[model samples]
Target: MKEFDIIVCGATGYTGQLACEHLARSYGSELRWAMAGRDMAKLRSIQARFEVPSHVQLIEVDITDAAAAASLAERARTILSTAGPFANVGEPLVAACAHNGTDYVDVSGDAVWIRKMLDRYQEVAAGSGARLIFTCGFDSVPSDLGVFFLQELARERFGAPAKTVKGRIRRLVGGLSGGTLASGRASIQAAGADPKIPQLLANPFALVPGFDGPAQPVGNAPVFDPDVKSWVAPFILAGMNAKSVHLSNALLGWSYGKDFTYDEMIMLPGAEDADSAREAADANIWSNVVRALQIDLKPGEGPSEAELAAGSFEMIFVGRTASGQEISTTVTGEGDPYALTPRIVAECAVCLTQDGTTATGGVWTAAAALGEPLRRRLEQRAGMSFSVA
Candidate 1:
């Protein structure tokens, strides 16, 4: 099949633009990549603004057009799709990629959509040798890769895997792109229309591979678990990220231990200090009120150049091995967390193409193919670093 090394679909959108910029800055000379979208004019505009090289093609096609999508799949070894809310408008592109044996990646955190995709496309993908990796961005990448890193640490330190892994966001500060906000609004609206969508969200297995179990109530809102010595909240993206890590466990088999239980939480700053914890609680109350009013505290279309240069976030993954060894690793990165996601998604496509990971294309998640490699790259090139403690 004729192909560019990477094809970034939805490259004209906000997150898509940042992704293209990051890719160009990092791999422009070495990688043959291009910009793509439904609007050729918009794609051309982005190309002109960025001064994209001649080698990078502009493939304009609608994600909804199956035939055109198939043509795109045939033209690119790897495809990074920033088009979403995936539950609404992502399947056709996925189908083309599976059929054409092209590796696919996206920044989707939709559990129900993932489940549907796995059911509909997994077999075709397997036959075609396509790898469809999803949620390779802010929503789940940090957690997925954190799990992988922790498990690797467990093996190296204790000669066995951790029976339980916990990922707590120690601190997060960033703005969301308009695209992400729109996706979330759409998800909320759709959920309001379909009650099941809202209910299924609480189920951890909602997006997990090989999990067809009926839904049940979420166990409990997280509280201070003295065992882990951290206060926790119901993880906003747990349904997506937790399942991804589990799927990786299933696919990679021994990389992540059997009987592994994973959970995520937002660790409010000063959770351990009584005064700071009280202040945090008050802040959370205010934050919820603002969200209720739809006032986005982290306001921005995306990060500024200065923020991209100076912005950073950190997350620590805590692991407890079966042998009682405690391990932790920290992952840090630059740029607005949400804005940085699209770049992560775009880079995933490039990495998958270069790495030549073979998979029977079925629905997949970041943890399955690009998890470890991404962690490495995040450390090396993305102004992100990971280290064991």
Candidate 2:
């Protein structure tokens, strides 16, 4: 058995600190975990800052060191990484985890990076019984698991899955973190370096290696969706969420159906008319871009606690069958998306360790690998609720 149940690999970093705090405060002596990073002083400082439990060990892990990375993997049942631009700094530890049979999870929303991981380590992880679950954070969890919950209800009530499902971001009330900006910049830089990255990221099925479902609904435009009776705009991560959701569908033996169709959008708060909805959609897009460009924050710094406390969200998922049968679910969060991300990712690692999951030995999505158990953890412990409507 591994010496530790889980290791927070970037425990000194911004989001990493929160992950450590979550585990410490929520699980405490019940979990065997460690905080890992290159600088022991920073780890100690964070431990002090958060008033973390004394028994939780602190270890130095320089993921850039290949041998050290492997050694860290050898000591844990699972590792939850909070390192961002994971495309740049995440591969070494991921490789180590896959080879060492240590389950892994991260708070990355980058589809390009995930696809790269899938291509490189799918077979290795499967062979070693390692599960690399990615995008456990705000980027895709609400959408991924929201859809999972809706489909589950459909199975129970409608006797079949939904062929068409839509994810709407009713309220993604959160502040932009510097680390998130850096990740976006890193992706842009990567795309500049490799032309093919843009092509891959643009593909809706980029996360799925060998299969393409039917063409999806057009989502780039501002329109009033009749399904939900709301005017919707393009969500920046809708494409990423669709990829994760589609990947979940594939991983679950296409239980959602070979012809399953999915898309995501942002619902304008009070756009009662078509023109106003279009304007709001455009404003919403640019406001986010301007905020990102103008925010005077750096990596490891994010919204103030008050700002985070002021944020909340409700993501609505609508699942539809061929005969017009519809079932929907709402994923409601009581705090900032950023605040909730750490809890979600931490629970993912915990779910992998403590929850009895049927998944074995493969790169998996949060929804596919952990499924209902994880949903339960988030609902019960992660300050989130899933309501079937």
Candidate 3:
């Protein structure tokens, strides 16, 4: 029996603090969880601010210290991490969890870093019964699970898996965090330093490792789709989400079809009528401009409570079977993506501890590892809803 049901490492970071606040608010005295970080004073500050329960212990565990990380993993059945850039701070904790067989979750959207972690720890995690899950937050969760939900519907209706799925962001109201930008910068820097890193980043099958599926559509450009009757722009997080969805398919024995195809883009209303919409369709271009502006909220800085409450997103997934049968579903969520990420991640930790699948020990996507249990939990506990359109 571990001492804690969950341990939130990097508890002093902005997202970590949010996770703690959500855990405290949602679980209260019910969960036996603790906050762990290198800076005890910052951890204490979070505790004071959130009025964390007295039973919620605070542990000082440096992520870089292998021994301390191992001890921290040993003390918890599951660990939710928010520290980043993950390339710098994520590996040690992942290694510790894999070795100790402790389930782990993180909100990292760094695809390059995630690929490295999977390559290094997948077998170790599988052997040790540790479930290492990444992109549990807004970056991939909505897209990943939305595809899962749509595919399930497709199977039920079409009597076969959808060979192709398109994830389109219908509406999104939110802002990016400084931590997210930092992770992006880190990946960019790494790619600049190593040419092979860029190649891996470009490949949709990078996470699958040696398993390249059929030709995938290049979703990095804007296109007009007659099916959805909208102009679609490249989605910034599509790279990360695509890999996770593909890996989930692979992990589930290609239930979605061996030739399954996936691509994500942001849907802009008023197709061909709005010039500004066409300009906004280039996500990479705007992302670069935003990075140059450096106006994103810093770590521990985010939208006001009112702003977060006002923010929301709705994503539409369209799945097409080989026989041309199509099914669609919508995943809608309330609140700002960053603000609600903590709750999503917290519920993932809880689900991992209490109701995860038996085949859970591996590097997994949130949809593949937690599956319907998490999907239902998000609908019930988190501010998310999934339904057929």
Q: All models: lDDT?
A: 0.72, 0.87, 0.85
- Clash list (residue pairs), candidate 3: none
TM-score of each: 0.88, 0.96, 0.95
> How far out, in Å, is residue 37 in model 1?
1.8
lDDT of 3 at 108: 92
Q: Write the per-residue lDDT of candidate 2 for residues 288-374, one digit (tens) a residue.
A: 444455666698998788877888988888888988898888999978888899999999999999986888888899999999999
Ranking by TM-score: 2, 3, 1
For each candidate in turn, give its C-alpha RMSD to the true structure in angstroms. 3.4, 1.5, 1.9
Residue 70's C-alpha lDDT in candidate 3? 91
Ranking by lDDT: 2, 3, 1
Q: Write the per-residue lDDT of candidate 3 for residues 1-389, one digit (tens) a residue.
A: 88999999889988899899999988898899999988899999999999999899999878888888899999999989998888898899999999999999999988888888998999899899999999999978998888888888887887898899998888888776778777777788888899998788778888898897898889665678766889887777888889889988998889998888999888876657456665665343322334433665566666677778888989888888998988888999999898779989999999988885866578988898888999999998889999998
Clashes of each: 4, 0, 0
Total backbone clashes of model 3?
0
Question: Which runs of model 3 end up more than 4 angstroms from their true locations?
Answer: 271-276, 282-293
Task: Report the lDDT tens digits of candidate 1 across residue range 1-389.
Answer: 45587888878777788788788777776887878887889888887787677678887778788888888888888888887667777998899988888888888777777777888888898899888887888878878777887787788888988877777766666644556566667677777898888766656666554455333224235367564477755545656777777777777764665567777766665566656554564455222322433635231255566765565677777888777888888877777675568667766776787765555567666766766776666766666677884
